[model samples]
Target chain A: QQPVQSPQAVILREGEDAVINCSSSKALYSVHWYRQKHGEAPVFLMILLKGGEQKGHEKISASFNEKKQQSSLYLTASQLSYSGTYFCGTEGRGGADGLTFGKGTHLIIQP
Target chain B: NAGVTQTPKFRILKIGQSMTLQCTQDMNHNYMYWYRQDPGMGLKLIYYSVGAGITDKGEVPNGYNVSRSTTEDFPLRLELAAPSQTSVYFCASSGGLAGRNEQYFGPGTRLTVT
Candidate 1:
């Protein structure tokens, strides 16, 4: 099943912080985060595996909570380049080849 | 290396027509996938292959067929295309190992069926 993302659209000013949450009905083995601009392929941000591991990239970080079956992406001091749609892909036990992506969260950062 | 490449970035097909969307990867990844994205909607997997000669259906595989005859190529065939099949298709590959499964996607093909 596909994951569910909260806050369908979010508009933020530069230097603001925003949190995007993704929840899955089935237990997730790993949660993948990607960002896509208009007319472009999604770019990988980071993958959060089981055991509640948190990974960070620059001012962005994500945490995977297997017990809660959810993940959250945190963006701090957002930049203009961060303006894009963010999607969270989830993989369950039997999923190895492809991922089930959520209906992305549209984030727009204004300068 | 060109991570993952898809051919015919865009195409328009008439009803009942057929076409194939080609996907290739140079990274020698063992896992390849095909997905479709409707306007303002999340991507839904159409088909996937773990390796050459092993293909399986995904969430939405009714109007689509796939073949994996080589490690670098996985093509998706749409037979008797319908207007419902109008969407952007993406081909992706991932390195499947102990725990790494980050997928690299192609530019995507915007297909319109009239």
Candidate 2:
């Protein structure tokens, strides 16, 4: 089940804020967030396991809603270095099934 | 220690050619995975292994094959490549622990089949 992400792309200025949302049709056991800079490998940001759980990485944070099968990533006071593509991967009702990711949200932070 | 490493940063192949994408991780993770990313698209799982000698197909495993002979190494093979197989391939590994879902990723291999 490919997760659905909102705001496929967004642009923000330095010290700005943004949110990227991901939802899935099926139930999600866990949600993983990662960021990929241009020409670089994707770096893990954080993971939300239980419903209503939240995790953070520096100025970024994420929340998972088990009932809605949705996850949201919040970027606070964005910086130019924050410019990258953000991906939300969901491990849905898993046994042996691997993580399925959304299309991704391209974030651009301008100075 | 190198988290995860993939060889052949980039490659161009002719149709019907065969090649292997090498992946090795030093973290001694229990789970390893292979994925491909298309232009402006999310990464799609190609194959995954929970342990050595145990591999399973992913969502898109049509033209690719994988083998895990050791804990630290997972290799993906392309047999008779097709133009549709051209994509950026990534290798990843993770511990089975709940909090360790954050998989370590390697710089992907960009493969183009003509």
Candidate 3:
């Protein structure tokens, strides 16, 4: 099944903050995040492994809560370049190859 | 170096044509996947491979077939294509099922069927 993402769409002013959440019913071994611009391929953001393994790039960070089988992407001090669709891909016990992606959160930043 | 590469960035097929979407990765990754994206449906897994000689069916693999003959190549074949299959297809790869490895993606193939 497809994961659930909150805040289907969000608009923010420059320097503001926004959060995108991805939740799944199955237990996850890792959570993968990606950003996709209009008519472009999705770019890898950061991956959060189980057991408090945290990873981040620039001001974008993600945390995977093993207990809840959920992950959240935190965008701090948003930039215009952050205007895109964010998707979280979940990999679980069956193996990572069978990834189920969320619908994606459309984030728009205004300068 | 190209992490992952896909061919024919855009394609338009008739109702009953066959085509193969090719994908290659230079990173020597063993895991490869094919996904389809519709307007607001995000991405649906079509097929995936664990290694050169092993392939598995994903959620939406009815009209698609995939092969992993070599570690560097995984191609998706569409036989007797239909308009319902028209969507943006993406090819991606990851190292393995270890840790939190991210999957590298190639520029998607936008296919339109009429």
Candidate with the greatest lDDT versus the true structure: 1
Where does model 2 exceed 4 Å of error? A52-58, A92-96, B97-100
Q: Identify the runs in model 3 with alpha carbons over 4 angstroms from their true place.
A: A56-58
Candidate 2 per-residue lDDT over residues B1-114, each given as its tens digit: 988999999999999999999999999888888989998999999999899999988899998899899999999999999999999999988887323367789999999999
TM-score of candidate 3 against the unseen true structure: 0.95
- Mark the 10 consecutive residues where model 1 chain A has the least summed lDDT: A51-60
Docking tier of model 3: it is: medium
Can you list the residue pairs that collide in candidate 1?
none
Each candidate structure's TM-score, on Cα atoms with residue i matched to residue i, is 0.95, 0.95, 0.95
Instruction: Give the C-alpha miss distance for residue B74 in model 3, angstroms.
Output: 0.7
Looking at candidate 1, what is the lDDT of residue B38?
95
Question: What TM-score does the A-chain of candidate 1 achieve?
Answer: 0.92
Candidate 1 residue lDDT tens string, B3-101:
899989999999999999999999999999999999889889888888999998888999999999999999999999999999999999988831346
The residue-by-residue lDDT of candidate 2 on A1-111, one tens digit each, is 789999999999899999999998987778889999987888989888874565547666777888998889988988898899999887733544467888999999989
Per-residue accuracy of model 3 over A1-111 as CA lDDT, tens digit each: 678999899999999989899988887778888899999988888888777776657667777788998888999999899999999888744765557889999999999
lDDT of each: 0.89, 0.87, 0.87
Candidate 2, residue B5: the lDDT equals: 95
